[model samples]
Target chain A: EAGVTQFPSHSVIEKGQTVTLRCDPISGHDNLYWYRRVMGKEIKFLLHFVKESKQDESGMPNNRFLAERTGGTYSTLKVQPAELEDSGVYFCASSQDGRVYGYTFGSGTRLTVV
Target chain B: LAKTTQPISMDSYEGQEVNITCSHNNIATNDYITWYQQFPSQGPRFIIQGYKTKVTNEVASLFIPADRKSSTLSLPRVSLSDTAVYYCLVGGLGTGGFKTIFGAGTRLFVKA
Candidate 1:
């Protein structure tokens, strides 16, 4: 089976610009998650989606960031008016029933805000 | 979410067994310990997980004591390819949601 797929493995945008990252999870997976890791920092959870519904969005940093999973097949994270500190590697993961087992992650999208 | 603590780095050689220990003193009853391996420019890959006792897989082994306060990930006959960052996470599927928290992680350098 094909693993999780992320688009645009790398992206660079100027500050105050907008950037969007996409994630395609495995088939039949019902849960999708978004995470980001800043340089030399731990990976932080962004939000979660369960079949088109936002299950947990408490981890979202601010209002400028928005995540949506339409139809629950794939997810997209958008950072508006991106700041320099927003640069990081964003990862997407999926699991069956959002359980601890069988959670697969994509290679990640490295975002650089200049 | 339970916070985990692990060594900042470790050194080992090829054909040697490497063990990385993590501590989660405030782990809840439903919390499980999991380990992930990450290479440069890639996302993390799951290595092993265990609630208690020992769990072994094709790639590594996870050992958790009875108290469940700590756990160890053992890599047998590690090679240069095994040199990467290892993250120890403690969490579970709660009624709220699945929130995984990662620490600084241990940078394991496998030498020749």
Candidate 2:
């Protein structure tokens, strides 16, 4: 089975630009999650998706951030009007089942907002 | 989710066993201990996990004491590839809707 894969590997944008990060989870996996880590900070959860439905989104930092999982296979995190503080690593993870094991994370997309 | 405490860094020589301990004093009854390894610019990979007692895999070993307040991850005959950050996560199995948080993690440096 292929591990989780993310797109662009790295991205750079202006402070007011919009950025989108994509994640393709393992086949048949039903759970997808998004996390972010700012410089010198711990990795924090942003949201979770079970199938096409969002299971939890309480971790999202603000209204400018949006996450979506369409058809339950892939997920996308969009940051509109990205600020300088948004420059960090965005990670996407997926698990087959919540009870059986821990999640598998992608290489992460390094976003730098200038 | 329970908070975890681990060393900020550890150093070991190649072909030696390395043990990193994590403390979760307020761990609940259902929480499980899990460890992950992460390298620079890469995502974290699962190492080992256990509830109580000892669980050993081909890659590493997880030892959780009876109190469940603390656990240790043991890597046998580690090599330079094992130099990375290790994160200790404590959470319940079915605690739906709760997020797993990764702390600062213990940075392990392997010497030649």
Q: Each candidate's chain B TM-score?
A: 0.96, 0.96
Q: Which ten residues in a row have the lowest lDDT in candidate 1 chain B?
A: B90-99
- Clash pairs, model 2 backbone: none
Clashing pairs in 1: none
At residue B1, candidate 2 shows an lDDT of 72
lDDT of model 1 at residue B52?
95
User: Per-residue CA lDDT of candidate 2, range A12-66, in tens?
Assistant: 9999999999999999888888999999999998988888988889999999998
Per-candidate interface DockQ score = 0.66, 0.66
lDDT of 2 by residue, B2-92 (tens): 8999999999999999999999998888878899999999998988889999999999999988899999999999999999999999877
Which runs of model 1 end up more than 4 angstroms from their true locations?
A: B94-96
- DockQ result, candidate 2: 0.66
Off by over 4 Å in 2: none
